[model samples]
Target: MHKYFTIFKDSYYGYFNYLWSEITTFHWENYFYGLIVVSLLVWGLEILFPWRKNQKIFRKDFWLDTFYMFFNFFLLNLIVLIFLSNATAQLFNDFLGLINLQLSDFQIVNLNALPYGLGLLVFFLVTDFVQWNTHILLHRVPFLWNFHKLHHSVTEMGFAAHLRYHWMEPIVYKSILYIPLAIIGGFDVEAVAIVHFSALTIGHLNHANLGWDYGILKYIFNNPKMHIWHHVKELPENTEYGINYGISLSVWDYIFNTHHVPYDGRDIELGFEDDHEFPLEFTDQIIYPVKKKRSKSA
Candidate 1:
């Protein structure tokens, strides 16, 4: 009994300390500020020039998405950063030591060594490319598709809808992103902050109902119109794997021949075609990806 109790105590203290460290590391104030700023900006745009003019400001699942925005941004992301990213980084460090190749030596370009603006651009382009491929793999792999389907299950696109992803998703995304970016470490904390802010703005914008056509820039950046097609029920002819997988830059999609833009929004139905049985509640949705029985039956 004493042995078991000692083991339990050690485990409890370790977890508690880890949690406190992670909580402290997180920029709570900045996160809230960004959320509030982006929310107001996108909310204003949606109300002023909504793509589906008839859609209400507080559409169906609006509150649900609100909860998801908080849950994912606050809790899920914290877990990924604290646990998954740290573990991956440690493993990578060990691997580098074994190979006698340090991370600093392999860095393609150190953002700290470059001009601030140039560093920001390089980091943004590199990270976006990494994420672009990750997004594609999630779509192509059946097991990953089951988890990623939660994001696509959003019938109504809004700013908060950008955070509507499965909890497991951030773990995979952050892990994949950490290794490559860590080795390429010119991007200091400030550069990362700038890139993250840009990502937050563009991600919310793409998921927003705002009817910003963006004209020729649609080819340059992923816009509302182009991103909407990604959620459309059916894909265009000759496109099977999926289209518009680009998160920030549309150039990747264009280069890979996965870009699809319609002449006009005709029948823009969102969400999966056969997702009628998908869970409507937040708790159920959280567990949906991990429901082994359901996956087996499907």
Candidate 2:
């Protein structure tokens, strides 16, 4: 009994130490590897299992998407980190204070403990749900909609289009979604890393042209079919807004009555009608909305 107890304790401590290390170490190369693999997977799946017969990929699309992806991953992220980190930190602190919540206490279970995995999974699911709801709220609220509509204006749904968001979004919206998780404390760096990769991979997969039907998987995962509907250009046609809202899981949409499935085999045109007049150049997209809003007010 004594020997068995010693073995268990050592294993538990080892796992805990590993988890702690994963949280503290930042590996840029690993992040790049993840981004490349996800992009290729999206491209390959689009070629192999396309959902829309009429949707065509072109070289211009490829280059444009690449530019947006690089810009979002590097420059936009840096801007948010520098300008919004303190604001986000304060918001998180206030939120926790409001809830009177403290960090979850980590208990030592064995290396292969079920509780550890369960805790991590729960944390991931909860965070994704929060993000999905926040995303929906941004769409529904008009002031916030001003910033978010820039994303919806993209008439294309491809790997690169994922980066076509307003600069303020990551700071204002996405930052708040992660703060609760950060405050919880027991969530280690590896879990956070896994969640980030999983969210981006599943989000890209949803944005791809893949033809796979999620079936019941739609209940748990946000597959491509469900998300494509969110990009549908027709006004009333876009009503099925609830499905596949989770960055990875679809459950949040179902739970919140936002889950939508695509019907009507015809290619639902993508992007706003007004977007046609806008310049495709990156600098123009950044300033276009602001100019339009100002013109309208005047």
lDDT of 1 by residue, 240-278 (tens): 768899898899999988888866653488877587878
List model 2 lDDT by residue over 1-298, tens digit each. Answer: 5644554555455544644454456464355556777888888878776667567865336576787776676555444444355444555556667888532322233222347778777777667767777887777666667766667766656666676677767766666665455444446667767877887878778777666647777777877777776776665544643234456777777776776664742366776556677667768777876887897899
What's the lDDT for all of these models? 0.78, 0.65
Worst 10 residues of 1 by lDDT: 77-86
Cα lDDT of model 1 overall? 0.78
List where candidate 1 sits over 4 angstroms from the true fold.
Answer: 1-29, 99-101, 292-298
Alpha-carbon deviation at 166 in model 1, angstroms: 0.6
The segments of candidate 2 whose C-alpha lies over 4 angstroms from its true place after superposition are 1-29, 87-114, 237-244, 262-266
Q: Pick the candidate with the highest lDDT.
A: 1
lDDT of 2 at 226: 72
Error of 1 at 198 (Å): 0.9
